[model samples]
Target: MKRLRDSWLTFVKKLPRAYSGRPMAFAVLLGLSALNFCSEWPQGIPRPAWIDTYDRILPDSFGSARQLLFDHFQRWFPRVPASQPVIIVAIDDKTLAAAGQWPWPRNRLANLIDAIAAQKPLAIGLDIYMPEADQTSPDKVAGNLPASAAALAAGLRALPSHEAILARSLRAAPSVLGAAASAHATADTSTDLRSAPILVHGTDPLESVLRFDYVLASLPELQAAAHGQAMLNVALEQGTVRRVPLIMGLGNKLVPGMPVEMLRVATASPLVEVFAYPSGVQAVGVADVQVPTQPNGEIWLHFASIRATQNRYVSAVDVMQRKAGAERMRNKLVLVGLTGTGLTDIRATPLGELVPGIEVQAQVIETIFDGRFLQRPAWLKLGESLFIIAFGMLIIWYVPRTDSRLAVFIRAVPKSSAILGIALNLLLLLSCVLVFRYFGLLIDAASIFIIESVVMGSFFSTALLEDEAQKRQDAAREQVRNSGKTGAGKVFDGALARWKRIHRSSK
Candidate 1:
């Protein structure tokens, strides 16, 4: 037992001294890399503010650069022509100009639906919400009338309400109404208004889905009449819409989003299936279409360019006036929403354009059909941390050991202390870009570059300080040796030896 204790103590004592000089710097690099790995822990310690800022700025800035490259690729690459039959029926300035003004009466909307239904569209999703009864209805108007107008008011009330007309139209066609999920709770807890059943394939599925305390759904009459209702809310990051959720949780029930609901109706799938794992919801399947999403069931949309002459849009006025050709509208999923400036539905996309919110939804559906959604693999973070550690150690090992002559040769053109370091980092960045371009994978190498640069800089600074200290020590030793050979040094040395002998005798 004593021997074992002594051995343990010896190991602990030797641990610190084991790392010295270049090895000590390498040890510090490994320690920093370990911290980097811990920073990514799911329920780990909170990172410092500067680290958080570094993470936020570096990746987003690099992402913007990558987005530009992707834009150029889209322009130059030979992409498979998109053939998904999805169209946005935008209520733009032209549409509003031709179809009266904003908030056209529900009856007129009903007329529009009737026209679209005649074309046999696979599904009609109303991105616009009718939360309350239309104010222009006869009942609302008759209430403020004079008592003497009772007969006239009663006659007006006998006519069908606009809500009823729109509801009836919804029942006649394959329609899905838009609803929104709220972070705050409301007094209403009616579960009967839910439109779809959420099926869980794994344990604790609700924990992984985005939970909402309240839902602002369509009126009961409209919701009941429609084939299904889907949430219109989208997830935003830094006040910008980057990802769209496919499923949301209200209490224990999971609800579909507009695009997913539209796909359900189009595919004639009776139920939307959500697959879950211990981590979170994995993928959502609607009939034959399976969409893999983030743990929260949101997809990072790979946006395609919107061309003016493309079949991406058909003006609402054209649809209403029966001007849209049958060949274009038939068997297509149509999203109806306002795109006029004052509508406030504009969203900033990764493609660096402001498009209608409904257009974002259309893009998501198109991405799914095209099977070209961008994905960051689950193993990427682990792979990146390991790479940073290995590469950082390599830099620490290479920078100080690099021959001065070789460094001078490399620095001949640029004349920088970190010429090799800069070249290696650029190489790392280029490799990342190539991976993204070829494999559609987004690996964040910014952190690795930052770590390597810091480590290499420290290594060189230490080497420089050590060199200066060695020169000072060498100069002091040479001065002592010269004084020893001089006459004044010999006399002083003899006197010092006599004083040392007397002091030793007194002790």
Candidate 2:
């Protein structure tokens, strides 16, 4: 055993210690290994198992390597087209202030509908839910209007409750109304008062997020009105509205989406395709199709400014009075919803804070019309995990073996510091101009930055200490040789040259 140990040590010493390159190679391998291992993590990020916890963290800005890769994948994939048949007529702040406070008389809304119907739009979507009878019904209450506006007073007396009046006007025109579902219902609430969603059979988390709770429009009434009804749920993750689900899962079954299915039914296209998995769901035109097995199956919204549509802004009072022109509203999508400040249907978005509920629906319509859906695949996660691990491993292998501290220092500098790095970042920025740029796809450059900085710093530190010691040794040797006057000059020069060569080769 002693002899074998001696032989092993001798063999190790004899082997040229010039394997400085092996450390770098080993680091590259290590980084690759880490990336491969991280690929298996569910959802691409480290998430808690509970739903509530996940929701709390969802809105957080902490992005992962996997998220970055997914963004890249989307850039490469083909975006579908948008074909929304609905329009939004926001009851904006101007109209709200002009029309009076909450629950502007039913007659006023009736007048607005009368004017909107004149446009002959494809259909109208009412985002407001009228769950109860209005207090200002002409027959139920009287003398609410000022005598000066009595000409408008005469019209108010004949109008029905807002629900009945809107229902009547909707029935008269070729339009669709909104409806809510009881997915969030509890036995504590009255079932009669609560509306049920147009549920299929199965219940899914993604579907729940996508389904909307339409107010007054019920299955029977919504079915009886205009042409069809849509599920009005907006899918929001992390308080951010990203994608609109194309299909909704209710209870224990799968059903066509409110807007998506409505358009499909109206267009007389094939059945609505269902694209669902553990990650998310997508719906395609029911012919030969592709599945979106990405993180969240949402499509990009193709927005049209709400103010752009003409005759689109008739006040309720103007519409009822028939004082507004109808020519501008022809062949447009009509969505009626409350844009009042007092109303609670507001959400925070990147573009603006406290955006109206109608705007949310408008976003949905935009995505539907554009057909540019966001998808994530398992491969994206796989790729990201591999990147992280591989990067980490590379640092471990490369820094220590390098004799040329300067080379390590060059690698330590971030890739973005140079003109090439800056140009690369600029190219990414330009990609957004030529195409769509998703911020989520950015790499964790800082992490790599940290690794390189530490590795390079350690190498330089070692080189500095060794250089000082060598200088001191040369000084001492020269003094001793000068005093003794022997063959020390040749030996010392040879040793120093060999040391420099070793350092150069290591680098």
Candidate 3:
């Protein structure tokens, strides 16, 4: 019985240390970080999550330091921008009131073309679609009118053959009219191209995000009427238009985008260079010249203030009513769009709220002209993953081993965990800011930090608990042995006195 009891006590004494808590702690930490990672994961994230947030906040803390590191990386590993070429001519509210009501008469548009032709821009782009005949000029539609509908049809006839008329007018001028083409779509495909055409298999800034369809409306008659065809589609994601399409694959046909079409006609170059990478692509000037780069083929838009004097605006009504001449539009891009109170053509962006369509075009122009690019290369991702994993493992080993009594006694495991978390976060923040500000590359860094912190912290916590448990067991065993020795001496002395008294009485 004594031997059995001794064996049981020995087993109990060793139990805590035998649990092997460090590996389990590592696993728990790793799992926790993963959970945090998925919870905060953003949609359309192109790079590592850590890098994305780092780009936003690093500038706040250590301004230029962040950018320096980023540039260092970009200089070593380069990426190409998208090559699709296009430009936007927004038909905004100022032009609408100036031009006269929503959907102005066809003849006024004809005059605008005649004026544009005089400037001889490579090719004029039309975003407005004229699919049906005008309802106010039936005589014109029937080919029985000698004059324009605006002069004769007060409210009696619908204008017939407006698309054909516009086609005729544009054909006669030095401009091109854009169209919408529906191609290679299944029954379940969502037809949400709005007024723009649809094309499948488009490119985006990153593989993780969705790409917009680059579709162009095709009409042989209209095609022949103009110098060239360009896709008139602008891509919008999460209620914001960020990317400018350079190339779009439609019906197994790689079509030239708005920018591409514009550059082709402007330069008359047979082959324009198309840049490709994670963020987006851009069409460069030509092969001989150094190719340019841009993030999502986007640039800063310089708005012509509505309050400006001569640059303010020219109303379509003024042109129609002979109040304004064609000279105002000479050698300039004229965008006509509606800005009526009820007619909402607003889109959200990183800049501000309630941005107009024409401004979007302006931004595109700024991006192309300025050559500001942002992106990360494929190798950067692999580098980030490896770095994060190693950082996490280091935290797991070092944190528990730290001899900071205050950390263990006061803040406990939470403090150590926090330290690990902050370290990982700082590394990510620095990486993103450095790349974006200096190198002009936008890499995601947030994802890596979150994942590493949890993975490493978990290992530390488990090891800490086990170590504490073993120490407690040793202390308990020491107290038990001391108490047993003290009690044994008192019991033995009392038993000897009683035995001597009993023997004296028997004698």
Using lDDT, give the best candidate's number: 1
Question: In order, what lDDT does every prediction score?
Answer: 0.74, 0.50, 0.49
Q: How well is each residue in 279-320 modelled by candidate 2, as lDDT tens digits?
A: 444333433333232333344343333333232344444444
Query: Which candidate ranks first by TM-score, i.e. highest?
Result: 1
Is candidate 1 or 2 superior in lDDT?
1
2 or 3, greater by lDDT: 2
Models 1 onward score TM values of: 0.79, 0.58, 0.59
> Per-residue lDDT for 300-411 in model 1, tens only?
6666666531467788888888888877778989888888769847787655666778877887787788787666545676687778777776665555554756555655
- Candidate 1 has a TM-score of 0.79
What global local distance difference test value does model 2 have? Answer: 0.50
Residue 469 in model 2: lDDT: 61
For model 2, the superposed segments whose C-alpha errors exceed 4 Å read: 1-61, 64-87, 97-100, 105-108, 137-162, 179-226, 237-239, 255-258, 265-271, 276-280, 286-297, 300-325, 352-354, 371-378, 390-507
RMSD of each: 9.0, 10.5, 11.7
lDDT of 3 by residue, 1-507 (tens): 999999999876554334444455456556544443333332233547565565565422322333333334444433232321222333446666566666666666766666555544455666554545555445544456555655565443444344556667777754544444444453323223222222222353333222334333434445566665655555654465545555444443344445444445555555545455444543334323323434343322222222221242444444445455545555444444444555535755433344655445434543454465454444455465556556666655655554756346536665655665576578777767666657665564655644554465455555675778778889999888667776668688789899999999999
Error of 1 at 334 (Å): 0.5
Q: Where's the lowest-lDDT run of ten residues in candidate 3?
A: 300-309
